[model samples]
Target: MAKGWTFQSLIDEQMAVTAHCQTAPCHHRQVLDLVKLRDRFGPDAPAMEWDFKSKLKCSRCGGNKVGLIYTPDTSPTGYGKAKGG
Candidate 1:
């Protein structure tokens, strides 16, 4: 079973961009961007934290990027969605 997730926690974290960043030199910046994105979207509310956690490659580095991955309107179990669907 799964539970509903909200962006309250993420908002507290103050991330900017929601997605993971792969840029090596900017890894720290990536984190900052995520927080910034969150802040931009919701200065007091984030996009909502995913109920489940998943591992995704950094969009900039192409390697395993560690962090909380947010799935829109879906639970972590839904990560198996068909590719390019």
Candidate 2:
């Protein structure tokens, strides 16, 4: 499902992604865009092609152990159901 997602891919596209904390009893998740990393995590945030997975953290758990899951652009992207019939 992740489709071998990597940092390079993120930098190259505006991917809808969810960052999940891997800490026990604290699976916090944050939905974000690839372009917002610098604004959210700061300009110095680590975005290495290989170490990308280790950069994300949960504000609730403060854990660096994170999981990056890919998400499809929905609603306006026409990938999700309309608001109403």
Candidate 3:
């Protein structure tokens, strides 16, 4: 886990967070809403903390073995490339 990565940090970086199910036979992934998370958990909530994982359950398999990933937005107007190469 990256140090000092709070929910606000992700928002500031315009990064998207996803929850991945690590349970065997259930590899489900879902993009999380940062605004909603920040609202629910507060902006200071630790983004990579284990306590956050305890609050999440895989919607597909109802499993607790979940992991988080932070990815920069890759839309044309977002963080990745420009309108054209």
Candidate 4:
């Protein structure tokens, strides 16, 4: 597992976090609010650490097998590249 990436890091980089349910028959996914998560877990909490998975639960299926996905926000106000260069 990589280290040094934290909730603050995600927020600073405008990364969108998503929670995905890995349990059988569920496979639910939801975009996470980085501010709320930073508040709950503190700004320094490990963002890419697998051990943090134990702290997550699926709201839809009520399962503990949760995984996190990090995506760079690509909206007009985000860090996406200009089109048709």
Candidate 5:
């Protein structure tokens, strides 16, 4: 696999998180789980995003708002901690 490529475990995690969500009357916990999983797995898992929107709908309640919050692109700044005030 290429660098940054998503593994099957990420997909499995998404599935487990969304299984119950597939049914109506979804729960919020499931959505949170999905967000966490996606964050842990990163934006490389295709299984997580394969719907009409070509995106991974939130696992909690199937809402698109449920996504991993992204931090600013700091790779160019080097892998160092920020300076203290």
Candidate 6:
């Protein structure tokens, strides 16, 4: 919707999101509410300062290299939409 959604913006919006493992040969990912990120690192911690890669650990292989992504609207269950449509 905007020019480009920054990792900071996503965190600020508290949108449901996913983090993918960036480690080679390990394509692990997880979707969770952005609030968790804020909660874990504190609201003042912007995306740049949060160092999300450092904060997250891949449950499958314990990889630290991670990338944040916006969760796509592919849910079959109609709750209208998340945050706002």
After TM-score superposition, what is the CA distance of residue 71 in candidate 6 from its true location, in Å? 5.1
| Ranking of predictions according to lDDT | 3, 4, 2, 6, 1, 5
Deviating ranges (above 4 Å) for candidate 5: 1-17, 21-32, 48-85
Whole-structure CA lDDT of model 4: 0.83
**Candidate 4 lDDT, tens digit per residue, 15-81?**
8888999998999998888898889989988877484778889999899989888778767756675
Q: Model 4: how far is 62 from its true place, Å?
A: 0.8
TM-scores, all models, native as reference:
0.25, 0.56, 0.79, 0.78, 0.21, 0.52
As a TM-score, model 4 comes out at 0.78
Model 2: pairs clashing at backbone N, Cα or C within 3 Å: none
Q: How does candidate 1 score on lDDT?
A: 0.42
RMSD of each: 12.1, 5.5, 4.0, 4.5, 10.5, 6.1
Ranked by TM-score from best down, the candidates are 3, 4, 2, 6, 1, 5
Candidate that scores best on lDDT: 3
**Any runs in candidate 6 off by more than 4 Å, and if so which?**
1-14, 48-50, 71-85
Candidate 3 lDDT over residue span 1-76, tens digit each: 5467788888988888889999989989999988899998899988774758888999999998899887786667
- What total of clashing residue pairs does each candidate reach? 17, 0, 0, 0, 1, 0
Clashing pairs in 5: 31-60
Candidate 5 lDDT over 1-85, as tens digits, reads: 3323243454443333332223345533332244554575555554333221234464545665432331222333565776554
What is candidate 3's TM-score against the reference?
0.79
Worst 10 residues of 1 by lDDT: 46-55
Best by TM-score: 3
Give all candidates' CA lDDT scores.
0.42, 0.64, 0.84, 0.83, 0.40, 0.63
lDDT of 3: 0.84
